[model samples]
Target chain A: MHNASTASTTEAATVPETTSSVDSYFADHPTPPFLDNYKDRIQDLLDFHASSPRPIVLITSGGTTVPLETQTVRFIDNFSAGTRGATSAEHFIAQGYVVIFLHRRFSLLPYSRHYSHSTHCFLDFMRPSEDGKNIQVVDEYRPEMLQVLTRYREAQSKRRLLLLDFVTVSEYLHCLRASALLLAPLGPRVMYYLAAAVSDFFIPTKEMAQHKIQSGDGSLSLTMTQVPKFLSILVHSWATSSYIVSFKLETDPKMLLPKAQQALARYGHQVVVANLLHTRKERVVLISPVASTEYTSNPQYSSHTIDLAPGTEEIEEPLVEELVHRHEDWQSTSSS
Target chain B: MHNASTASTTEAATVPETTSSVDSYFADHPTPPFLDNYKDRIQDLLDFHASSPRPIVLITSGGTTVPLETQTVRFIDNFSAGTRGATSAEHFIAQGYVVIFLHRRFSLLPYSRHYSHSTHCFLDFMRPSEDGKNIQVVDEYRPEMLQVLTRYREAQSKRRLLLLDFVTVSEYLHCLRASALLLAPLGPRVMYYLAAAVSDFFIPTKEMAQHKIQSGDGSLSLTMTQVPKFLSILVHSWATSSYIVSFKLETDPKMLLPKAQQALARYGHQVVVANLLHTRKERVVLISPVASTEYTSNPQYSSHTIDLAPGTEEIEEPLVEELVHRHEDWQSTSSS
Candidate 1:
């Protein structure tokens, strides 16, 4: 299954003219073979997009990590049990999209199996803890997630697919890198939402001694280093890249705009979300920088995207609408 | 603890303005404690009225079933997960109201425990199948829920209090009658959102055997009968002596307004919300008659209160602003 890890894109790929100018951006994107057995996944997504006069979006969730050390890695951890990320995924699906949820272990996302762009089956690992045991867990696998993936599995029955599990930051990075390469052939319309709480820094941990640290905390004092940024990895790793968006949380409100603009400038991302630890439940602000194009046939790039003021209210809708529309326009222009 | 169950009014004893107006209407009410917890209740309620700068609304949630055979019986159960009720409670709390949430068992509310007004902790019950020995159960007796109810419990600490758990509907009704009496002295500002789906029709299964019914070729009879309606009970019960609001869910949109008006007319309630179930959500239209009057040198009833068409986009802020303005008018009248 990993043999076609980085499949070559067709030199003369057909662009369907009947599809809207926005959809043409995702011209290279594979629709992941349609099958009759899966009841929920494809039909809902196709019907919603074909019916509604709005652009659809997919938001990937869970925790992404970076490797900083060889002996032991420095990880950026959050208190999030995946409630906010999971809720956002639900809202996006409700808004109608072929949601490609690259969720982490124990995400507890609703209808995960029948909710992906690619109907791929993956295994998630879990170790028992007291708090973990107490959470309102649905022990049984969700029907929708299981059913769709199994259908896809039979279609590609010839090759055996691999299922890998991770414990440390290095392992997560390796998995993400491998997955990104496989998804590189996807068209530009793919809007990448980096909502995961990725550790910005990591430290080298000894592979043999790493298992020992799980049982007991060693006198592990070490140096830390910044890992390759996800947004950078996202853009540079692919040729026909998706619209990347990253989050920036800071203490100062005034610094939010500059930091967001910096992220956009540094990574060439479409949107940057900034939030304080205090506003975790309530208010959040997102700044979307739409780059204006001159002498372009596509009239959309004629205007620039504006950064809306921050409020606790549902800003996600307006933000997505503006960003996706821009993405659609940008895709058509770049492809043409 | 059951003694706390009584009427929440002192109008019968008080020789206030319009004793005759209500006296002529309700002749046969549930016995004295007719206005349960009336004296101290009324005083504390008056304090809340004087202090609160906004509309004070109390929203009740969950189901209430009528008994058929044994005094503690439930006939039919509707698929109510308490979404509407719990969501409504959060909206009320958001609007800055001094909210008093009368919730039932197993509600999926978010800020219920965090909110100051959430009622006492109710036990959630689950029974295993015939083959299974152990049962699975989860209850929300969070430290926060206990903290909110500590004051109420302390006041009645000197006296004996018994906590009753209800699985069948009749026990729920019995518990509510007493609970409403404790909340009765709250007066006109009280806005009860009766979102619970009390069984309309029930089979005579209250006294059925605990053992599972085996499949048989023999004739099985289900004598279905109209269970006592909670709506009618509220309209007729002494609980409606204070300002009350009821909900009406109908299949037909055309029937909504007429039924809502009928509910307002029958119950003498301030508001009757008529909703059409479009999928899992309700599209509501309110019918509020018998508006409350602010005390003045010449006490005059204000027929105009905040009435607006419900919009799916956003209504939280608008509702708060409208309710607050109306409350200010009430305060102005009271001060003068």
Candidate 2:
């Protein structure tokens, strides 16, 4: 099944005008161990989609690690907890979309996000029974726990969600490519939600220390090469018919809109969701080819932005709703 | 209560011959938000110790993060899951020591480590009732869960364990200093187990980028200054009467013994536990002023190293037992 797509990708491996091609990048770096199971997982997804014709969304979450050593005692890490991706996946599942959640190991998950990332310890949510023979969810939290559990169990029974995970940038890239190619047959019915905060720079595999770097030196100087831009390849070749929506997270407000616009222009993806580091939870700007609009949790922005009640739901609830609407429109247009 | 110690620390803040002192380092870096509560936590510890009169051990666990930017979209992270520190804390608590666990945020805790860091999902350990009305721990894991829960509750009820956390290197340093100074009144009754994998290099506050670094520049060149060695200050002034055990982790076999010896000689700490990155779980070397010895999970090294049958207990079990014996010897000799 992979032979034809692999051949086309290999043949399409021209030197990109700015940086190395995705094919060359894969060649230079060793594939992750989990890649061995990728074929089986993709086959399962394909087989499931054939039997069920719901729109499938591949949601990448959390932050990728860039190992400083081959043995890996130290690494460069991006700041992400996988909150966005996990929450978005739950929403997608509610919208009747099948979700393939590709997340960072130990990060939050779709159903588990609520309790997993809470400030309270897992044990804190449970209490000993009156007889002290068994433990159960605390009285106050039982209702909510049951609701989440029911949804999670329902999704599992229906096989609507698939959980896949990665740790390093290399693993994420390899998994992304393989998954994209596997889902290409679904065409515009598939949506790629790239929410993971992937590392921008990495020490090449060959250059990385075999062991932990010695700390005796007074100062540490590191030179890292930029990770080659793969979004262009992802859009143009791997999943050409899929609706691609990439994220742009910046600390500076000035850089947010500009960078998001540039990514849209360069990759020709359907949408670029721009966000600031501080206000990302409360606000986001969706930049499409024709128009850009803001979304906020603040009720004051109701006229211009998709204003959601402050505590009623998360910013992602509205954001994903808008995204699903746009994706439906794209599918109709493409089919026509 | 803190005035006398603050005055003494300020007077003792002479520029060190090799590296900057802890006082100067704190002066250079801004204090973390939790500093206000540090005193209260310390007072609580002191009051508890005064009533119980048990030996107190401050276990510093997990890896400290070094932020690349002030807002911190990316950071340099040391590879540690806090297994050593968390495991050791449980052992210490079992040995009747009051444990103050100062760990990195989101890292493992002593009693919680087993269920929390397991590869299986938290929900996997739980099952819905036959009637589908409630969730309970799966039958297979019930014995272990009950044992852990009983111990956790016992510790909480007795106030024998205090949990504190930090995220950044700066916060870790400040917290360490404050806690040590507060514990100094106990003199030889206290022990400092420094197990945290602290960053060797960090971007100073003034030099760090205010916003997320622009990735358009293709390549990234980062020059990080050496994190001022504060062990000298820790040994010379802060909690001087306390028996200090520091960790020296290296990937290179040749560097491990030498580095461990150097740290012992330079800081004059009671013990320096040396371990290779890969073999840390299975084996470790205890280097003290008088002698150096190995501790291993492998029974093959039983002749030279302290060896226990695998699966009987963690390597830390024997390691902590030996340390407690040594610490008892130290207390008697010093008093004499």
Candidate 3:
């Protein structure tokens, strides 16, 4: 298998740095048109829990697209099913946390994830009643449907979850910044779970074609600019006192730990959940920084791997429990 | 609006001709690995309809992807909802034509299309019964669900529909050829409805990166070759005796009729259904070649526009009726 860390580090030296600073990137790109409409809803959600003790989490899911044209008949897309974020949100909701799910427009969501994109059409679970005037769930599928329905209805009635959507990398970045600034007031009680597979390169709006790219040319060549990394800005500027968790996905097993540790040291974030592409659903390693000793000035690193339990179908349950403990610990110490 | 026909025409003159022949394109690209399995199913369907007078139609829907890497972390995609093909397939089935639905995986499908991928999640349609032990569709939605369920069950029991899927342009082309040749023996009794939004450019497998493309470099440039046009080959070589209908989608109102007429002249195909991108669901113009007189030397062109009726919802119903009539006319005259 290819070693992802080696490839990335080796390439970094030979390439001239063209990564834009976050400030310049925002100045160059326009904010999404719908951001204004979302602001009021976001403010209302934040205000609803302002005086309560419930921890608010912003979970970003799915993959962002890099459009090659302004009109976008064609674009480059990253591979992601958005399972990690969706599953994690469900676990958090069950544990009494308010979730703000910012995801790709049509990617999976928490409760509905069980049925929407499954192998069998949702209708397959239904049958006409004896009179043929009503529809009822098949006997074999009734229990599961009722359980999921109950939870979905409870979530809806409680109004504990907020759903937001984006499609392009530009919109994602703008939404992230706006959200981080809005959540900054929550301090240690807020968590930013950045699980979205964001694109690392994009074609600037000014440089893109107004119409669809024509294919009559013998060979079509596209030059895309490097997307700026914003973890540092989020840590030091946007949400300095809030807990932050990011993900690192690599195909090489050997690169998982080191790359994750490197991210913790570089970004000064609280946690990095690392996993290999093929084995992601079964296991993940959480890497974080800890104090070495009571008197020591330097911090030590800790890595813990969580595996799917013998009887469980998903690893997200255990993963979320672990994070909640760490978040609680952070809150107690920070407040003290 | 920008004229699509003019843009394509003016670009063709300035660019070097690099379009490949059908034989070479197929020779260069390997067929999908699963083709062997589908061949048996294709044969079974063909055998079942051999003695019956029922007409068989192959409807290709959805958009094809162009992968940039062999492992496929990134790919260029064409935008399509696959509504036209899915809606038309339902109408064809209702009109007594056996359907072979060749669609992109996860795109819309007949019967299931009404529920999946809609604004409300499929779960929104269901609720717990009075005892809370069973699930039932909401009273308001039960009637529509029962109607769709009836048609779906009928189609399933009759074995009149076969679903096949593809993702990449390469796979689509290979599948198209295999299907056309397999259906060739049916002669004029078959119809090929090509509504897929196929990519015009693709990176050859041999030339693509073995792993995910690195974004550490300052600027990434990708060069893609033009995909060989396969309509002429489909008309003349693959299924010469089959009735064929293709679609032309354009943004310019002025180009809708002329470009469609030009396609009929160039490809020697039976019909081209043309529509503007914004108003495609509301209206379409069917352009076909007709014998002008009993002693005419050349075929004359006929253009008929179909608009959504005041009370009706879908344009596909009327569109399919028109094509069925045309297919019947062609069959009667050719056999005579």
Model 1: CA > 4 A from native: A1-336, B1-56, B63-75, B112-167, B203-210, B218-220, B232-237, B279-282, B290-336
For each candidate, what TM-score against the reference? 0.34, 0.90, 0.89
Supply every candidate's count of residue pairs whose N, Cα or C atoms clash at under 3 angstroms: 22, 0, 0
**Cα lDDT, model 3, residue B158:** 84
lDDT of 3 by residue, B125-186 (tens): 88888898888788898888899998887887787889898988989999999998899888
Best by TM-score: 2
List ranges where model 3 is wrong by over 4 Å: A1-24, A290-301, B1-29, B253-258, B290-300
Alpha carbon lDDT of residue A203, candidate 2?
90
- For candidate 2, the TM-score is 0.90
Model 2 chain B worst lDDT window (10 residues): B294-303
lDDT string for model 1 (A221-255, tens) is: 32344444545545544423556666665545566
In model 1 chain A, where is the ten-residue run with the lowest total lDDT?
A1-10
What is candidate 1's DockQ? 0.01
Clashing pairs in 2: none
Question: DockQ of candidate 3?
Answer: 0.62
DockQ, all candidates in order: 0.01, 0.61, 0.62
Q: lDDT of model 3 at residue B162? A: 90
Give the lDDT ranking, best first: 3, 2, 1
Best by lDDT: 3
